[model samples]
Target chain A: MQREHEPNEHAHHGPDKPTYNLVFVALTVLMLLSVGTAYIELPDILHYGILLTLMSVKVGLVVAYYMHLKYDNPLFTWVFILPVLMGLAVVLSLQGLAGY
Target chain B: MNAAHTSVHGAEHGHGHSISNEQHNHMLKFGWWLYIASEVMIFSSLIAVFMLAKRLYPAEEEHLVLPLVAFNTFLLLTSSWMVVRGLVSIQRGDQVGLQRALMITVILGSIFLGIQIYEYNEFTHHGVTLTSSMYGSAFYIMTGFHGFHVFIGVLWALWAFFKALNGHYTAENNIGIELFGLYWHFVDVVWVVLFTLIYVM
Candidate 1:
């Protein structure tokens, strides 16, 4: 069997072609869902909640597959996600303090 | 070890036999991740400011045009997919496919920027300048910085396209394209958050 050339010690085997197409389609569907959600009339809390939930799912897909974080080293994932968590905390705290 | 000694060792060990390229690429990715982590903080601060401003002054909500921004969001999402396709093509040793995908990605990025410019013009015409109000200032600062990021990503994609045309990449060695994809996708993810927090919510 022929071994694939490893770009780095931490890099996994690259994703297959079909996986990219699948992710592309998934992202498109999520985009449409989020846009559709925006047009629906719901209570303020529920409306924002659904929008944010959909946004989070989209972000997860992009970061995991498109960015190859799922295939790369866990260290890199920590490097990327920690800051995002911190940002979320800070944003939420500020929003609370601002009386929103 | 000294530079001369290291070079001699590298030459003796040869390319694939040595771990130099692998280690170098790992370090490169690590550094890029660190840079992006810092960017996360910067954008977080901008988002915080925007939220606070909005809370303090509710009138800013009336100024946003959701439908136009939603269309812009779709363009960025499509461009992100194109960049991923470019990466996938190069991974499969399809240089022509990579080049075409990258060219399309750059065009899409440019169109997104053009729409943003038009949006800003509309805002300013409606007295939504930086000095207009706290809301206006926050709005421009957050989205403008994001626009600047998209512009930079487009330039990066253009460079990648030129490199692909010059046959600088191959199936086994295309770290440049991968790194560019990471950056472009990061910009896209940022926009997803911004669009949700600012436009939709």
Candidate 2:
């Protein structure tokens, strides 16, 4: 003797999953904040400092989440970041040799 | 066929299997990084030359336009976000979303290019040409090179969008999406550093 019907228990994947929309929203906020701040004048070369800091934060977000490097092996992240550090070092050395 | 020849062919296919698509994709990504390293060297030299020349001729800063470059930077930053959204859409298996994001990205990229052309126009309107002064030469060379790269990236995004419309990518097969995303982000990153170096500082 069969009844009318029964709901499929596993129709959907799961009830507990994180939404990435919040991450996008946060990134958008940071991007806008940085752009707005760029309009303000800073003392001396500190403008580069502020811009670099904000750019790093923005790049960090993109690399970690958007690039999926967060879940990737630490070694892979090292490969991507090592070039950045090296590039900066090269620039610093070149600037030093060229004087101010 | 001879047994020796058959074994040779079998070993060749076996070696091919060992490399795998993932390995090939990683190889291409690493190649991109190496290309960026070369670019870093090139820009470092350009900055060095610019600083040296600026020290010799300190009066050229009067003609530089800051606001237009800032607007161009905003255009690129927004375009970067759109590129990421496209990749994310592909990751989520949303074909329509991917197409929409890519379209927005191309539009933003075009706006950036348009701004660059306007900047060039402004330069010429004010009697600034590549042969005008050392500053003018460096300015056009550095930024013109970057603008050309942006043009290429826009075309790449358009092609990717077309392919996406034709069902080229799926959640499980989205390495192409990631590769283009990486290239797009690299272009954005280079512009970030450039805007700071060339315009702000």
DockQ of each: 0.50, 0.16
lDDT of 2 by residue, B70-114 (tens): 777777767766766666566667789889978888998999999
Q: Candidate 1: which stretches are off by over 4 Å?
A: A1-12, B1-18
Best by lDDT: 1
Worst 10 residues of 1 chain B by lDDT: B1-10
iRMS of each prediction? 3.3, 5.9
Candidate 1: residue B132 Cα off by (Å): 0.7
Model 1 pairs in collision: none
Residue B101 in model 2: lDDT: 79
lDDT of 1 by residue, B95-139 (tens): 999999899999989999999999889888878888889989999
